[model samples]
Target: MEEQRALRPPWALVRGAGDGSGWPWRSTLLLTVFVQVGSHFAAHGQEGGRAGLDAFARVLLVLACGQLLWRLRRPVPVVFGTAGVTALYLGAGYPYGPVFLAVAVACFSAVVAGHRRAAWAAVGLLWAVHLLVAHWLYRWLPPSGDSAASWGQEAVIAAWVAAIVALAELARVRREQWERERAERAEAARRRADEERLRIARELHDVLAHSISVIHVQAGVGLALLDSDPEQARTALTTIKSASKEALGEVRQVLDTLRTPGDAPRAPAPGLDRLPELVEQAASAGLTVHLEGEAPRLPPGADLAAFRIVQEALTNVVRHSGSRHARVRLDPGDRTSLRLCIDDDGPATGADAGGGGNGLAGMRERAAALGGTIEAGPRPDGGFRVLAVLPLRGEEEVDR
Candidate 1:
């Protein structure tokens, strides 16, 4: 596949400063050619016998050579165009040593400007014509080791082609390297973006998921008593107030954990080590969420994991089951495993009983990230169950 290149913006003056083929090379090549040809002509007493232009040809040659400056902005076309003009000048018997040098340089520029194959093809065609030029020049030299004409005729072509070609190839490799670095940077940025998004999603789940579930439970209790009993309604109102304040505090804690301030100490994440309060609060809300377990003290991550499971299950009960009874069971396994299960007898079957879709998905993702698994489904008799088996040790221990 052809790799896409990011084109640099054109300079205010140079149309394609980094595009096509630009600057010094074009002018430098033409300059090398110009100096040689103009000086040689002047040495031969041509053009009024000075090292400069003729009244008419001087203006034209200077201008034509100056056009080499624009080759990068227009590479292939300038090359062909210069070659055509040089061919005409050669036909007119005007010496063009400098123009040939300029043409070779332009071909090199074409390669660096991202036309490597095209430039080589062009060199081939130009060399074919150059061979004809060579044949004509060779005819004048006698066959001898020291004959000046023999070497001079071919020396410039070989030297100039090799030097410029080497530089062009170097430029090609550098361009490829630059392209690779740019792609790696973009990929890194994409991965970081994905990571940040997942982090925000987890935080939202932790903070709002529990609090909303609590509010829902309290709201239901309040609504049930609003008409039937005023004293009971007042108690529900107090519960709502207390729940809201606590929720706000938990929200603050979660935000603090998620954020890094210019200055602030980071607290640890809440875990099931503090589950006594969570259980007591749920009981106050009227559901008897009896929890039983001899589970070992889990890792910090697993502690939070177990806590969230129970919290979510209790929330589901108050919101969907319409039942005031639920059970949470946690048991330690041999070595490095802990099994936790939360079940509720509620509405038994309803839209709300199916689990909070987004919340459940987030929980599963958290478990997966922690290298564990969870299973959730409706129980056979009634209600729903969430069974999660979290490995609490090193991969080696867990595997064993």
Candidate 2:
């Protein structure tokens, strides 16, 4: 029992009745002691009765009430023990007192601990015993001819039992409701964790795929031109060096965001302001990219999404398209929307056209997340084209 008490959580004692600590047990024990000692004094001439309770009677009263200390953990057993002791006290013709209060408290603990039917059964048994004892007292002792007083006492006992049972049932209902709400909150937290993990996975995939593709192409070009064109070969080597460094920085940023505890410093996400750098890298990889209109003002999230979409599109051009030149156009579609278009000539023979992969799926997910739409397919002009229409209003609303 001591080991079990030590293993119990402090919160269980506070929130429920089963743990053997807190105000419930302390108050019960204090009330029992006070009532027992007060009754012993009342039985003396202080209450107009010269027949005082003997030492043995006082000891039995104390033992009966003390049994309630374990009421929360073994409520039913405590109820039976207290009831038996009270029967012995009453049979021995002792003074009537608060010794039976322990039985009521034990019954209440049983109900709060989710043994309603059993608690009701215990109450019935106690009521029967009380009636039988009252009958025995009426027969063995001389009647004072006061029938009203006897009936009144029985009514009071019945009322007390009803009140204790009602309060215990109410407490049980309230505790069940609390447990349900706690479960719902735990489920909501789990769903949020799942969503965050998926978002981080998408970010890592886009950043790594684009940067690594650029480095792979630049490395091949540097090796192929090392002997024939030393000057261009050196430029390819320079692009590879720069791309590798940037890739490492971005990868580190993503990892830090995931692993850091709280409020750690992080690099800012890429946006349209980095388009010029992207164009330069594409040029070094043997693709000429022509930039058009300026980017309109966008929310932070929309700006990052727009930059990734354009980056992925251009990366596909450098890897698959045989065309030396590609065109990128950005325009304000309306007061609340922006348009982006990228077109490149058909790929070289046997070069893999960007058809199906996580890249396209990731691009679509980003566009949809911001309430935008993207369309990509072969153009009538024998080239591949990607057109995206993104809403600025949704982003603005989210910012607000």
Q: Best candidate per lDDT, number?
A: 2
Q: Per model, state how many residue pairs clash.
A: 5, 0
List TM-score per model, in order.
Answer: 0.67, 0.74
For candidate 2, the clash count comes to 0
Candidate 1 lDDT over 56-146, as tens digits, reads 4444455446656766677777666655555444433444455565566566567767777666666555655556544564344322211
Error of model 1, residue 335, in angstroms: 4.0
Name the lDDT value of residue 399 in candidate 1. 32
Q: Which stretch of 10 consecutive residues in model 2 shows the poorest summed lDDT?
A: 140-149
At residue 19, give the lDDT of candidate 2: 36
lDDT of 2 by residue, 157-229 (tens): 8898798789778777766776777688789889878767766777777777777777777788889999999
For candidate 1, the TM-score is 0.67
lDDT minimum window of 10 residues, candidate 1: 140-149
